[model samples]
Target: MKDAIFEVNNVSFSYEEANEKAMDQVSLSVPEGAFYAVLGQNGSGKSTLAKLLNGLYLPTSGQVLVCGMDTADEKNTWDIRQNAGMVFQNPDNQIVATIVEDDVAFGLENIGVAPTQMPGRIEQALLDVGMLEFRERAPHTLSGGQKQRIAIAGILAMEPRAIIFDEATAMLDPQGRKEVFAAVQKLNREKGITVLWITHFMEEAAQCQHVYIMEDGRIVMEGAPEEVFSLPEKMQALRLDAPAAARLAHRLREAGMPLKAGLLHMEETAKEVARACKLNSKA
Candidate 1:
């Protein structure tokens, strides 16, 4: 991929004093401006991979390149992080300042963005996340999704090339999750920022352009959502379930109903099921 924003080449990582590798010989590329998902159950090495991409953890072996800068190179570390910002699972841990706008400006202040230019950048970032209206509000007063959006705003102010969301929506309620996902989707669609979303949410993965499934420190599956979720037995062996609609469609097919393979979303599944029923009635 000539436009690859992140290149993980034969990467492996292990914690100090740990007996096993968290990731083993894993390799993948995220194309520029693509919404990519890395899905796995807990202990699947997805989070470790996210940390390596952001320079929080160096690979024990192999290499990770962010926007073409080698992450393991000491000199390239700062630049790599600047180009590939991270949003972790906890929003509270990410926010620094009391007020929303100030929190968004924290990264800019660290990089010594000119005071005259800070307002414009901060305002834009907040606006991008749909949090401009709460610029003056205190961080603690915001909802979980709002805080996550603020965290994202902080990253956006730094003008990053890509963003890694490490289970960023896991802690939120359904509405909150929807809000944060919508904000991130808007960023990817309108601003053309590349996204790496690490989550166990199958529905979320279905929305991504590409999906990679990790298990036992390796990428066991990689493809478009339809291609991936099509294999129900394989996904089951990995201790992961296919998306709800896909599973339903599979069961219906096994029960002697005609249905298309790899039905991912509810709307599509409903239409297919209805069509099958109508055809059966005609017979």
Candidate 2:
């Protein structure tokens, strides 16, 4: 088994003056270079969990380890944040400079990277996110997707091994969401960077290697996308919908069709529907 990039053990967190825990006894592991998705609705502990993983918030109880370093230890704060970077919901909030390339260098500067070493890192990071052409452009003039890509490039320049995205696509349009997601996915696949993608979008989660569903600050479900989405009823009961294809596939199965469970994409669902119909016609 690959070494875990993140390990949460019996972790719990509660906001100050809040009546309930924000994260309750949650435990999970993210393997090195793996892509994991966390799905949850508003007020769920997903965002809080992201903060904890990045060492922004100490666990109210239990432990969170990043790259074998305990987050509770103040000494590991700097290295922890370096090893596990974060991209928040609003791209505007993350941008620190007027120029795109300067924004990319912000993290590198804080880490005390040498001036000479910075240009290469900045160029490569922008290239990786497909924003090299816009390196000299003003961030405020770019589209939402472009701005988000710049934010990702800034993190990439820091050379973090893992990234925690806290609903990073929530403020983006569909196109922007697609653009950001694709960039992050490419980094995971090609650069072997571990990702902790937190979002409420079922379609996005469907593409992840593993899915974790959070409700009321606790992990209500965790499995491969297919396994979890196959139970559309359970998902619906939680006031969440599975991906359209998964829901449709479940309905067909319930209606006496032998279509396979956990179909996610529309194309896959269409193919199965046709196959099932053909089988029925022969019968």
Candidate 3:
């Protein structure tokens, strides 16, 4: 598609001396400015796919394109990375500078961004991630969520077309995860930036516009969250779980209550339960 920010066509990849392909013939398209999620269990190849999109790993077979540039071509590597920035699980590994603002500027410095143009970019990036007030604070002094936002600010400084989170919230606590997730969603919604979120959390995946489920090195399912999570049996077969609301709805239905499928949010599920049971407001 012409609007695709990422085009993976029949791509497969294997690690050095690996016994088998980590990803096999995976094909997907991420439209420009779309929020997409890839869900999988460990060793299910989602992370490997993330690396391919960012040009960190080239496909062993077939092609991976980012904004019309082929990742296999050595010349496209630098531009590909700049356009498709990646945030890994560990924020500490991504932080290089002691101070928050300097860490965000580290990428701009490496790319030789004109010194005159850097202040505005740095300040805006920090503000975008809600970290401007912490510009002078030491990176180590910030909480996990703050550190992750700083990492995102670094990517935003590059003015990336897309940002891929490779289990970026895996190590965060509930509050930390909420903070980072909010920042990511804000960037996608407000800045028109594309997002490819790789995660195992079903609830997090539910927030995205599209979801791809991977199992045993291939895409086992792809659809909107409601479409995918409606099948509890298939999700479990892939070693995945439905979001809490969906699970509760499924159990209620099985117990002889009349409820609809694909109930993904709590408020909707609560309303449905009340209607099905003919409960009064007090109940």
Q: How should the candidates be ordered by TM-score, best one leading?
A: 2, 1, 3
TM-scores for candidates 1 onward, in order: 0.97, 0.98, 0.96
Clashing residue pairs in all predictions, respectively, total 0, 0, 0
Cα lDDT tens digits for candidate 2, 1-283 = 9999999999999999998999999999999999999999999989899989978899999999999999999999999999999999999999989999999999999999999999999999999999999999999999898999999999999999999998989999999999999999999999999999999999999999999899999999999998998887899998999898988887778889898866989999999999999999999
lDDT of 1 at 90: 94
lDDT of each: 0.94, 0.94, 0.93
Better of 2 and 3 by TM-score: 2
Which parts of model 2 are misplaced by more than 4 Å? none
Output the TM-score of candidate 3. Answer: 0.96
